[model samples]
Target: MSHPPDIPETDAGPAATPESEESLEVLRDILFRHYRERIAELEAELKRLETRLTDPQILSAIIAPALGNAIRQKIRDAREEMIEALYPIIGQTVVRAVSEAIRDLARTLDAQMRTSFNPMRAVRRVQARVSGVSSAEMLLRESLPFEVEEVFLIHRETGLLLWHISRDPEESADSDLIGGMLTAIRDFAQEAFGRGEEGQLDEIQYGDRRILIEAAQHAYLAVVVDGIEPPGFRAEMRERIITVDHTHEETLREYDGDPTPLQPVEQPLRSLITSAQPQELSPTQKRLLAGFAAVVLLCAAAFCAGGSYLWQTVRRTPTPAPVVIVPTPT
Candidate 1:
């Protein structure tokens, strides 16, 4: 029994030591702490990645291309809502602008009519007809001759120039800008005075120059005239504008800012120039009339002198000879 116990103790001698057990426990505790910290760090990193994925810029970058059509559909679905939200403000703004424009137009028309009906205006018209001059020329002779210097055809909604014709072609350089400015001014006047859709700026005067605007359903005509414009002239302009609108209604409706289609309108505008120009006497006709008048005066003077001389001769000698011959015959 003593030999067996000695052989077993040789290998199982440290089995019940407190220090070894404590070392094993410390090793286990160290492993647990390290694993727990690593797991916590991994979870924090995962949470950061998740937050980045939810970011708008990153999300849009990942999904926009694939969902573009779906996004557009969503916007379309909300369009009615957007319009409903904006309608009241937009409608109020439009109403106010239109009302202002109408008031301004009414005032302008009243003032213009007052100036047109003056006694001097009638006298000027008469003088223009008698002198073979334009009424504008007769009225403001010292400044600029009354002529339609330029004509601009513009789209009412877009303020785009459809066509422009200028007596002085140089003035056409900035016609597009002028059309935009005109539209802006018209819009401003309308907005300022609370004018409505029916209101428009018909005329703008600056010194001797005047811009006569005629509005239609889709477009307008702006004529630059220097001098007093006759009512007939304005009527003629309106008629021409109407004719153009009627003839090219389809083209104008479909206009894409190309001026080529408006070429035919040049002929009508040129005709206006021809009609407005007064038929003045040429130098040759003036000379011929002067010479004819001189000849007529000379002939009248000779006939009067000849008749006076004959009457004096008859009175001096003819009565005595007539009495002697009558007595001899009896």
Candidate 2:
């Protein structure tokens, strides 16, 4: 079959004319100007994301699980550097703990040794065994010679003197001030050394006199003594304090710095004075003394004849007459 005649090649539409080219260039410039700020914003956002991805925190979060072993090995290799960085912090913690522990241990051991091997305590124990009496009774008898010069019941928090009694009434004038000073000292110790509530001031000594302190939850007892305190004396004082607390629990719990609520404790304290007084010898000691006296009398009778000649010489001595003196005239 015959094909149709081929048409001559020609441009489909308008060719690249100068006016069209100029119009396209103007349009491109307008578009570029309009989107310039948005394109700049997108570029800035992309740069921020890139920087975040390179950060250690973000990078580690992304690859941590897969690179766990490698990361750990790297850390181990640089362990000396890590330790150097942390040395000051770790060293301070360990040193402080060790120092406090050693100080507490030394203080405890010193106090225990002092109480255990006291010479007066040893003597009292020997005396009790020889007399066939209880050590407590013997201690009380021995301590009776020493006086409880003063006693103070002080509030722990405010350092107020709750109650005070003194062997000499005139000495009670400064009891309140003394209690405040003791409290201040206790606070200073606790704050300076970072001691906890369990720490307390146990005693204050000046020359031959001392004030023994017994701390409780809300209050403390201070007893002034002129001589060595017997071993059982502190125990007795603790017992009395317990009794007082039990009897006055409610009043103490709601105490508002009032001294009146603790009045009842005074009677019990006075009873201590009576209990500490010296006692007479027991019947056992009296019978032993009487038997010794009878033996002495018999021995004296046996020696009477041997001393008769000496007695006769003493009786032969002459007696001199008394002389009267007359009053001289003025």
Candidate 2 lDDT by residue in tens digits, 143-193: 344667888887776788888888778746688798898889878877887
Off by over 4 Å in 1: 1-144, 194-197, 280-317, 321-330
Q: After superposition on all CA atoms, what RMSD does each candidate show versus the true structure?
A: 26.5, 25.2
TM-score of 2: 0.43
How would you encode candidate 1's per-residue C-alpha lDDT over 1-330 as one tens digit per residue?
A: 355445434554546689889998999988799898999999999998898798989877878887987767866989887678789999999999999987876675556555644444555567689988886555444232458788888888789988888888964569999999999998898888855555778899998889998877778889888777655888888888888888888888887878788789888867666666655556876676568668989999999999999999888984545444445555
State model 1's lDDT: 0.78
The backbone clash count of each candidate, in order, is 13, 0
List the candidate 2 regions with Cα displacement exceeding 4 Å. 1-127, 130-145, 194-197, 274-276, 280-330
lDDT of 1 at 186: 85
* Cα-based lDDT at residue 133, candidate 2: 89
Candidate 2: what lDDT?
Answer: 0.76
